[model samples]
Target chain A: MMSLRLQLGIIFIMLVVAGSIVHFLRRKSIDFRYALAWLFVDVVIIILAIFPRAMVWLSQILGVASPVNMVLFVGLCLSLVVIFSLSMSVSRLADKVRKLSQEIAIIRKDVFDGDNRVREEMNNIKD
Target chain B: MKKLVIIPAFNEEGNLEKTILDIKENAPAFDYVIINDCSTDGTLAMCRRHGFSYLNLPVNLGIGGAVQTGYRYAYYHGYDIAVQFDGDGQHSASYLPEMAERLEETGSDMVIGSRFITKEGFQSSSLRRLGIRYFTFLIRLLTGKKITDPTSGMRMINRKLMEKFTEEYPKDYPEPESVVTVLSEKHRVTEMPVIMNEREEGSSSISLGNGVYYMVKVSFAMVIARMKR
Candidate 1:
């Protein structure tokens, strides 16, 4: 059984996270796709806070020594997944930025030269 | 056939003028573009003053990114062949036409300007030569293709390979790894004998301290690249 103080602490953390997610969503700062992962994490935390016995039961089933250990293990795994996803996204963004910069350089040249021949030829080739 | 030479320069202000002049005087038939890799020097100023044909990268993309930019330009501009020539005055423009011709004659997708093939002209430091030899043996062990000068920056690629390179290219210290990539992709890579001069000004980007790191990193990349298939 979780102590009242521990339960309250978890509740406080859930509220803070939920508030931040709401604020981010309202401001449209993060995409819904990315926010969905955070929302899922929030839901898991809330569920664990409400039913502390679930963690105990999971801990017993997983042969872990304590519910706290189970919680830490799950948290570490989830953090890994989150970090891995973030790294993948960062890699993709880097590639996109690189491509954008290359295109910008080429387009800037075309614009400055007052000749659309290269641009036109590129578009025709793409077509 | 329209050929484009890519001169990737980074803070090579001292040599850029003479290099450009040499290309204009010797390899005038081939169109050239200087990729100024966000040099923190008078290189860009020189380009603007001379009104030289160049693509100025807003950010420092390193040598790989700079060369890939040139390849991308060649692809977009519909050049039949693209040659990568260094801006440090090390690569000879006189040999460029012959390199392009070798690419066409042998029906090879790429032609490398090799110094070791002739065992002559600026073979680099002995330690660097050892690293090159190690990579040569490693590449031979992995793939049947043997590259005498895998680290040579002077290379020419046909349009087909240029299209591929524009899409994807190695990031840093890319010369040797790119050679491995081309070979693994079943592309024909041949080498032509050429004499490379020592850099006229500025030090090489690969310093003595980082030489070991470079060798290890590039060798690791070469092995990992082979495992992809």
Candidate 2:
């Protein structure tokens, strides 16, 4: 039986892969930069998932004498934070651009449709 | 149909009422919008007091950002023709109809109200004139469009071009920079000769020091605009 920590890492990796697949299916238009970012994130999670013994080797190399599981857990936690921050930033920028475009479209429609009711209101002030 | 004029005002409480009245008097068929660029002054209060249908920007996002706000407003509000009228009381409302008519006849994306096109009454400083000439040459060399008055803010934009502007507009001093942006998007932009008056009150937002900054910002924006897709 696998250690509890190793089992959690495997489950986390599975969740990420499943999430990425769902995102890809929904968007249908995935650019290279985002693809590369997700690829790096997924690869790191997979490495931590499959090779559980490699954690001991990494801990020894990093001069951490604590149990291998603790070292691996800390490393994985740090990686998760960094990846999540990066993904959030990219998504935020994308959202801003999308919102800007939508706002522009709405304004264009109003202009062409002759909805100058505001002007009429202003004209009423002349009385 | 009535014309929609977008005047992006940044702390121009002194001049806003006059400019607004000028449009109302001279071009009654036209409606105007004032985009307040987060003025700490009583500009917003004045707009509210006068009951002008204006947009209040949350932060001070320079001239280009403010103008883009006006374009976005014009795009959604339903106007036959959109004109960029300066809030400094420099642009006359009388010339608005001609610009709008030209846009309708020629099907051009944008029609600039130009002072450089004719020797008829343009009294700008020599330094600004020199800068305008340099930008005009740069535009011709790059976009193959023989355009003058690249820095003139008084312009009439059609629905199609207004839509493009609302989508994505340059963020710094955008007059010259946006000419290239408009042209690169396969849109036709031209200039018409017009009389330009000097500002009656208030100083310009951009200082002499900002001239160098403007050139660098425009250069980068031009490069980005040239990119395909």
TM-score (0 to 1) of chain B for each candidate: 0.98, 0.94
Q: Output candidate 1 Cα RMSD.
A: 4.8
Weakest lDDT window of 10 consecutive positions for candidate 2 chain A: A101-110
Give one digit per residue, the lDDT tens place, for model 2 in A1-127.
Answer: 2477865876686677757755885697665555665566566656655665665666677776654464456557766776787789876775475456445534544563445666777789986
DockQ of 2: 0.08
lDDT of 1 by residue, B1-229 (tens): 9999899989989999999899999998999999988899999999989988889888778898899999999999999999999989898899988888899899999999999988888989998888889989999988888999999999999999999999999889998888888899899999999999998899888998997889889999999888876
lDDT of 2 at B50: 86
* C-alpha DockQ of every model: 0.57, 0.08
TM-score of chain A of each: 0.81, 0.42
Supply fnat for every model shown.
0.50, 0.05
Model 1 chain A is weakest, by summed lDDT over 10 consecutive residues, at A109-118
Cα lDDT, model 2, residue B186: 82
Per-residue lDDT of model 2, residues B23-96, tens digit only: 99988888887888777788889987887867766556677777877777767667667888898988999888
Global Cα RMSD, each model: 4.8, 8.5
CAPRI-style docking class of model 1 based on DockQ: medium
